[model samples]
Target chain A: MSGTRGERFHVGTRKGIFTVAKVGGAWQVVEAGHVGDNVPIVMHDPRDDTLYAALDHGHFGGKLHRRPAGGGDWEEIGVPTYPDLPEGVEEDTDASGRVIPWTLKLVWSLVPGLDDQPGRLWCGTLPGGLFRSDDRGDTWELVRGLWDHPDRKEWMGGGADWPGVHSIAVHPTDGDRLTVGVSCGGIWVTEDGGASWACRADGMRAEFMPPDRAGDPRIQDPHCLVQCVGAPDRFWVQHHNAIYRSVDDCASWQEVEGEPTHFGFAVSVHPEDPETAWFVPAIKDEHRVPQDAHLVVSRTRDGGETFDVLRNGLPQEHAYDLVLRHAMDLHGDGRCLAFGSTTGNVFVSEDQGDSWTCVSTHLPPVYCVRWEGRASAG
Target chain B: MPRVAFTPNLQRHVACPPRDVEGATVREALDAVFAGNPKARGYVLEDDGALRKHMNVFVDGRPVRDRVTLGDAVSPGGEIYVMQALSGG
Candidate 1:
């Protein structure tokens, strides 16, 4: 699969979800939907080739839709919903004393379950709620273990208005094992299929937290968490302020420094190479533009020991593209990669991070990109 | 029975034409309207059954006072308008 070609993909932008395909050696947006709406997340289920798009209509609220495997009309599906705030619980507050309303703010992460669990789907949402759907998003129920954890109450938002679980990684072999990355809530792992959870973020530091609480795993934000499919024990995270790599199934982490900058949002691991991964670094904080007004993707071929800033086909002059956490994705072949930026530019690389091709320059602000994988589009 | 009609803007996402239903309050009227049009329910109200902050409901040209419970009284022959606030965008 590593030698395969880049074919079709989807980019979820601030305005719509576009279906981009490589037809006759050229990339084009073959189809587009929700043309003037906010689509924050999209998922291409390789198991069934099903495409799910989460459209957050600012006024009408968050909505989810999907096209079945063989590709059909877009059908509206149920969004992850939170149960009613229990009666008499008017003051549902987090540790920071902020009222965390029981509402569906936005769909941050939508992932399909392991191969064995075909009908199962996992969803993460803002205000920090993890949900499970057994019917391909037709219905959903909130998972209580992670939401009810005592430490979750202490989880506060980092760069967002509310704490959210944005990244969810399901174990390739163990369907019961799952890991989730919260914006400011650290990393939580569950081996009992969401029945219970444990915080495994030990060495990740948070410069934004107080000196005494800087190492608190419950509040140390890991912006994105990705596990190496080839080496399941290896994991990498683009933390809020630093980059860390874990080689023990997230049991511990070691800080890895970036060259131009150490802060960024997106990270992608090679399909079968634990020593290879890519990241998009930014200036961090108040100014989120690319470092030195140059957009580049950094690649680590030796498991974080060293990195090469690849910018052959990327913009290097006065470019302000911030690749979001969910905006970058790699095809199963690893050589075929793509990532979109907050500026609405979509770039693809057929030869890994060696070079890139700009697919679109004027779409909505890209929120997520899902590359077509090994599975057939059917 | 009161008549419930969604703002025209909603038709683009979900079709919710005017419907006549028996109800004494805004919540009941909406509940009756959503009974047959389940797809439009999430577009109008939140999961907890509260009216969306950006969506306003009016009964006979008056905005409902109780947004949470939608308990504002609705006259038997009153006309209900579910309008998306202009500022909501």
Candidate 2:
């Protein structure tokens, strides 16, 4: 094995953002930022060594802040704004008969733009809108073309009371193309930049939907979506009811079954290996706890040909930790992985799920985690 | 002019000093204060120009009846208070 540049990862928690670093040859919580606040989303822009945290003020609404490179004060930046409804337009309703408000409910996903487009950022939010930032986080503009699509009316919320975009993957080389995974709305792909989008989530099943509409792609909820950087055409979606794979650039999807459970909200693919992926499993539907109270990570090294439930160093009895969609992350080379759960626990695996170690506990409920350093030698 | 004061809790995240702003209604008064302290606008209201769901506004000790437009009338020299609705941990 060769040297690895990755050292730290930021964690978004129910009440603060924490930075854990490799100290004395072991991972330790080294710094805390934005304490005493609800931080639901955190991202590390490796391009510039900056950190972005999204704070949710129960009474004040959502806010975004970016710490510029070199570790300076966090700067409050412009958040995504929803333009008012057009004249004579009626409010839209979701499947549960709730009217989708034209407001920023929460900043769900923050992703750095492609390498070619420096200083560019993409923000995915609830109420289903994608915003693009040109000059880093100084300002942002909602991608209006996709917001006005005719098919968006069919989208609805899955676990949330309203629909939201929780996963975003940019093509490594194509700056104009990307895909966003929306809960209960499936995956939407844009080829001409943000000018247009289409729901290419065919073959995903939604048993939660009415029997007649079980196969409707637009209403399927992809809990999380990830693409292999080494193989852009290879994608994985931890759908609401089962695991799904897309090998044709999301043109189609197929179910990939895992044992003990097929329900979960987080999925990570090996950055350089399309055939490798990992998922945190829970009992299906109403029972979201770990199967029989055993916390395990299911991994597939042969493109779902088989799955190994890795439980070493993980809680295996009466554990109820539930990982959120953005809580699990993998290093660029996929040799190092980390996941945090709502139970306020964080664990790391260095040998790619063969073993694990708990790094922190008794913090706040963890919402998201991202690697802040370069990928390890794989 | 009505005296507008924000919850001290809000002051922790934003500098919201009590002030006398000119307005005939709750909306006008808040709009007056937010005009100079623009950063405080989002802390009090949501994107639709309405009081946040968990926020409350009081005019001279009475709850502002309309949270949508904040249309409740305000006296020339009355006291206005913007507070977070009481919540439990």
Candidate 3:
């Protein structure tokens, strides 16, 4: 942290959100808020230096909190609530035939609005609902097009009892265009700012389902999706069964050829380089721990043409931790990449995934990690 | 008035100090408490206004029969308890 001018890393864990900033030459916990609440995601709005934390209360429900940039007490912002079910539409049913009601179980992902829309924000929630907020986190409206899509009936759950929109990517150049990744429903794209949505899982595969339905778009599962900011057309998806790269803005996807293991929960892409990406590969869906109990990060500098395992500082054996879908992140020009594990370990690689250093080992099971950097004013 | 109390576990995420609220039914008693802290209402009840699956309500050491509408009548000086169900990994 010697050259840290304004670098902050927030780790969202099962117990709370931990704020660590570079003090002197090492990362130190400047503040640890939400002491006993489960923080699924902590996002920093770079436009205004505001931080939003999605707190998941097991007994209760999900709650959203925000704080200013420099750090202070968090103010509770109300969580998103779904509107009444459309007339004549029945409640969703699970595999067991139990009717599932619309509830905000968790705020899985939060993305800042386009550059031109100052106060706009987007949120993805469990139970497969996407919401938009025009006034920051104050008031939210559900994206009804996706909610009422015909494919929703076929959508199933991968990790939860119902499908959830866990990844949302707003195009850097086209504010109206965006993509959303669903756990069991696959990839969806809306070019008209959520007025309409279409499934983009044509080439993605879902091997976990029955053979007849494995290739269906609604049954595809994308664990994580990342878009290269420098090349908005290029995107990478860590699918439930394979790794896919799409060059046509998710119109069609092709499996990345050189992955050691085809399964992982997290994917990180270089901020400025569409060709460079990172993935923490684990065992198959049945066993999610690191492959062979060895924790290694696979880096592909040539856009998935080939991959090199980076494990200079990571555990080589008996490491049973798995990184959640949002537990890994890349910041700035991709000079820094950080990831956290369910075993309560956090690691950072400042040199673009060539090596790593342990940031913390005693945190509660980490759910997500994010990086915020402030440039030095000359 | 009924003596309404929230378990210590629920207090971790919300501030719910045991207090007396005037109401004839369980829903009325909870509504009186929610009037003071609107945020806590979302945590305890779903958007459809039903008790969350992980939450349980007890009246005088017995579980309430009407969980959906919370229409169970409260006896005079009855004690109500709100606690989280034991679940999850």
Clashes of 1: 0
TM-scores of the models, in the order given: 0.79, 0.79, 0.78
- Interface RMSD per candidate (angstroms): 17.2, 16.7, 14.8
Q: Candidate 3 DockQ category?
A: incorrect
What's model 1's lDDT at A7? 76
Individual DockQ of the candidates?
Answer: 0.01, 0.01, 0.01
lDDT of each: 0.84, 0.84, 0.81
Residue A218, candidate 2: Cα error in Å is 0.7
Candidate 3 residue-wise lDDT, A1-378, digit = tens: 213333678999999988777678786677788988999998988778889999988888899998976677789886889887668977766432335578788899998986699988899998889999988898888899998887776666667766788999998878778899987788999999999999988888765543344577766889999988878899999987899998887878899864569889899887677888899998876568887788999989887889999998898879998999999988764677788999999988878778888878889999999887521111
| Candidate 1 collision pairs | none
Question: After TM-score superposition, what is the CA distance of residue A274 in candidate 1 from its true location, in Å?
Answer: 0.9
Q: What lDDT tens digits, residue by residue, belong to model 1 across residues A194-310?
A: 999999999988665434455889877788889888788899999977889999999999999886788888999987888898999998654678999999999999988899999
Those runs of model 3 whose alpha carbons end farther than 4 Å from true positions after fitting are: A1-6, A88-90, A94-98, A374-378, B1-89
